[model samples]
Target: MVTDLQERSDQINSSDQNKIIIKEISIESEDQNQKKIKESKRLFNEGSALNNQNKYQEAIVCLDKAISINNQYDFAWNNKDNQLLNIIIQDMHYIIRINTKKQFYVMTKLYLLILNMIPIGLIRSNKGILQYN
Candidate 1:
């Protein structure tokens, strides 16, 4: 009975050792992931600055490069591309006086209204960025 007990203890120790090794690997992988996320966000912030500077052409190039680096990045919306595009669209709305009475509230409402007017199939059929692989 003592010998059987000793064998069981040895088996449990070996199993625990394997678990420790797997856990260490998982920790290392997670650290690498955190580093990548930090880098992606940094690129995003840089893109945003480039946009704010009104260097939209240059900002777009930078944003494209950043996206290629991290396809999952959504920070480009804060950059010059969106800012410029938004300005253009908003100007159209302002020119047309679409809900001009409540500029602040109408802004969101009109924007969504515009978005809704766009055909879903057209937006999703590779016409714009809604389609992501």
Candidate 2:
């Protein structure tokens, strides 16, 4: 009967050991995820600074890394898109300035494109539906 009691004790100890292992695994996983999130935010802030300095391409690279680390990072996504838009605007302005009369058609096309991209609409429909166009 002492052997039977020993067997029961061994089983309980084994189950407790399994629980400790699972807890350790969970804690490690949480720590790794927190590290990744912190890294992602660091990269995002660096990217934003580069963007403000007009180092758009470099900023985009950093932002891409942040997004890769945290795909659901909305701030990174929006910042990247904004940087791309700024680059496009700068390029369009340069082209218009450099090719004024010689490429009036191209300049006009670019202007139209920019105009169409206006983000806000103030139109009010007859039914007061707040039309965006």
Candidate 3:
């Protein structure tokens, strides 16, 4: 696992190097700043170790950090996962049903809420649009 992390880290370094080259050639947007993948890899390796020792909560924290860095990481879900992510689906259902507005309203609000709470981007207002908040 550590070896894997190191290999991944090397890949990230290459990616970052590429980014640096891009920035040198063209103007980069704020959103274009690649995450500091170094720290994320360290966290991933630590979490993997914790998971092997059956420290689930600790592992989850580390995995969550890694996910925050790179949401596409399936490795974060690998420690002790069930095929069913029922809890997440249940939460989504409850969020929609609780505010039983129109279907579109419910779905929009559900996504907005998750975006607001999670590090995901918000879908709603800056100057109080009152559209979905």
Candidate 4:
């Protein structure tokens, strides 16, 4: 009857309204995700700039913020790792340089002591022979 037709029409309209609302929500979600990605990228760029300026600690803070915003951000994670590694490498080089200097100092002292134990006449003779060679 006409009542049945009216009821079916109401159901179709309600379903269509639901679809439209769902679509709107989906669009909003996409927009929010885009905004998040954009913000994360901005933070990442700041971190990279700081890194280039040799402000490693500051760069790491920025990169950490980027990563927190987007946990899937590979670039932020990679940069953070690189910064940490650079710090470790620099520390290692400093240690090596210090050790090398200490060894050189000890070796120089030993050389001077050995030289002093040798007679001056023998040293002079050997220096003359070395010059001829």
Provide the overall lDDT of each model, using Cα atoms, as 2-decimal numbers: 0.66, 0.82, 0.61, 0.75
Residues 46-83, candidate 4: write the lDDT tens digits: 98999899888899999889888888787777677777
At residue 38, candidate 2 shows an lDDT of 98
Off by over 4 Å in 3: 1-22, 25-35, 80-133
Residue pairs with clashing backbones, model 2: none
Best TM-score among the predictions, by candidate number: 2
Rank candidates, TM-score, best first: 2, 4, 1, 3
The better candidate by TM-score, 3 or 4, is: 4
Which 10 successive residues of model 4 have the least lDDT summed?
124-133
Please report, as a residue range, the 10-residue window in candidate 3 with the lowest summed lDDT: 121-130
Candidate 2, poorest ten consecutive residues by summed lDDT: 121-130
Q: Candidate 2's residue-wise lDDT over 1-133, tens digit each?
A: 9999999999999999999999999999999999989999999999999998999999999999998888867788778877887888788778778877646776677678667656664343434334577
The alpha-carbon deviation from the true structure for residue 66 of candidate 4, after best TM-score superposition, in angstroms, is 1.2
How would you encode candidate 3's per-residue C-alpha lDDT over 14-105 as one tens digit per residue? 99999999987665443443444666677888987876675656777887887677655555544313112233445567766776566576
What TM-score would you give candidate 4 relative to the actual structure?
Answer: 0.66
Report the candidate with higher lDDT, 1 versus 4. Answer: 4
Query: Of models 2 and 4, which has the larger TM-score?
Result: 2
* lDDT score of residue 122 within candidate 4: 30
Listed per model in order, the count of residue pairs whose N, CA or C atoms clash below 3 Å is 0, 0, 0, 0
lDDT of 3 at 41: 72
